[model samples]
Target: MPELPEVEYTARQLRALIVGAAIQEAHVFWTRTIGYPDWHDFCAEIVGRRIEGVRRRGKFLLLDLSGDFFLSIHRRMSGNLLLLSPGWQIDTSLRETDNAAWQTRGPTFLPPTATDVAYSRETSHCRVCFDLADGRRLLYTDPRKFGRMELWPCFSEAEALHGLGPEPLEDAFTVEHFAEELAKRKTVIKQVLLDQSVVAGVGNIYADEALFYAHIHPLRRANSLNASEIDALREGIISVLALGIEHGGTSFSDYRDLAGKAGNNFDHVRVFQQDGKPCVRCGTLIERRVIAQRSTHFCPTCQQLIAE
Candidate 1:
């Protein structure tokens, strides 16, 4: 799944490529990808509009159009967005085609493949395509079909987007705010951070990484923390999220950047998927367990669970 960083990267890429382009047409291959207004309304309303800008709120990508409308996309699991010229052709079988390709020519060619080609003007797994006036195309593709594409007059009407916590990267999401939010939750610390309403844009990968960084066990109750622990957690959450953005996010599975390229952050991961591997800090073996039904990885030596 493409987490916050991955989704943010996609929005940034789209801003650079498609912001000024006018929508010549729109193609919706999968109707279910749009959550509201139905498929017919989406096509009629979005076409002929020019893209004003692209912005990301939490994990959702918002494309500001010429009028009051916006196109929102959520790449839930395997969703990706790719921008390409008319001549671009994606070969999904390239992994088998060249073993050294990613190592040698990988940087140049991979980001596009990480892009969602599910929707295109030509052949694609693209669920939606926005044809630009310049003959360029922006495509959204998700193989798992869990991704979503919707058109809205304003972002507030997208019920799922409303009431999300402040973005961790934003200037408004202060340590004091995070501390207050945690104070209100009696749930496990991990669960509190994972709650979008508590602090938006955090998911399994970042939640595990943040807990590992704070040296707080994933099962520790949210209200159990002292001021010092809360401070540490606040810093940990911001730092981990910042690092993930810097590294283009962790790409253990389907997560990729705007160009459809894989991210290298997986190599820098501390404990998320390093179970059974030696901890980088203390050489203790990393462990994995189910926390809130999600596979969580951490260092038992470093992160000790607080007793109830």
Candidate 2:
């Protein structure tokens, strides 16, 4: 899933690319991708609307359109918003022909394979297509079909974000707020952090990295955290998320930006996917365990759990 930083970076790039562009046409290859109103209504309503702004709330991308409409998109698991240039073309022939001549011709002459040709095709599960007035095309591709696109009035933005917690990067989300919320939860700290109502936009990856940074074991009960531990966790969450944005978001798999480029944050990760590697802070080997059915990674020597 594309978490906060990924969605934030994508929103920023997309804002730069399509802010003033109007939608000439809306095509729904998969009807289920429409989360609000009928698909027919969605298509009719979206046409001719200019994209005024692009922003993110948690992991949801909000496209402010003309006439006070907001298009909310959630890339649940394998969804990606891809932008195709005005005159883009796919050379399907490259995959069909032998292409041995090009192979030996040089690296610059190498053509895209059949896989590349079909990456953004309808056959590749491109659910929705938006043809912009500028001649650019925006595609919503979701292999799992779990992503959602909904159209609603701008006045309903509060309702749309009602259940989500405060944006961690916002000034309203102080350490006091986080500590107060933790006081009521008896669940493990990792699980509490995963709760959207407690901390929006924090998925498994950030939770693991934050906990590891705070030297708090994933299994520690939320209410057991002391003042210093709470402060450290708060700092860790903000630090990692800011770093993620700086690197354009982490891409372990499936996640990519508008240009189909992967983020480099995975290279700087301390323990999210480094289970067998030695800890960066300590020499002890990192370990992975399943907690709340999500993979949890930590250095045993640095993040020992205290019995409460």
Query: What is the C-alpha local distance difference test score of each model?
Result: 0.77, 0.85
Q: List where candidate 1 sits over 4 angstroms from the true fold.
A: 88-124, 155-160
Cα lDDT over the full model 1: 0.77
Candidate 2 residues 200-271, lDDT tens each? 899888999999889999999999999999999999999999899999999987787887778999998999
| Cα RMSDs, all models | 7.0, 6.4
Candidate 2, TM-score vs. the true structure? Answer: 0.89
> Which whole-number lDDT from 0 to 100 does residue 287 have in model 2?
96
Off by over 4 Å in 2: 88-123
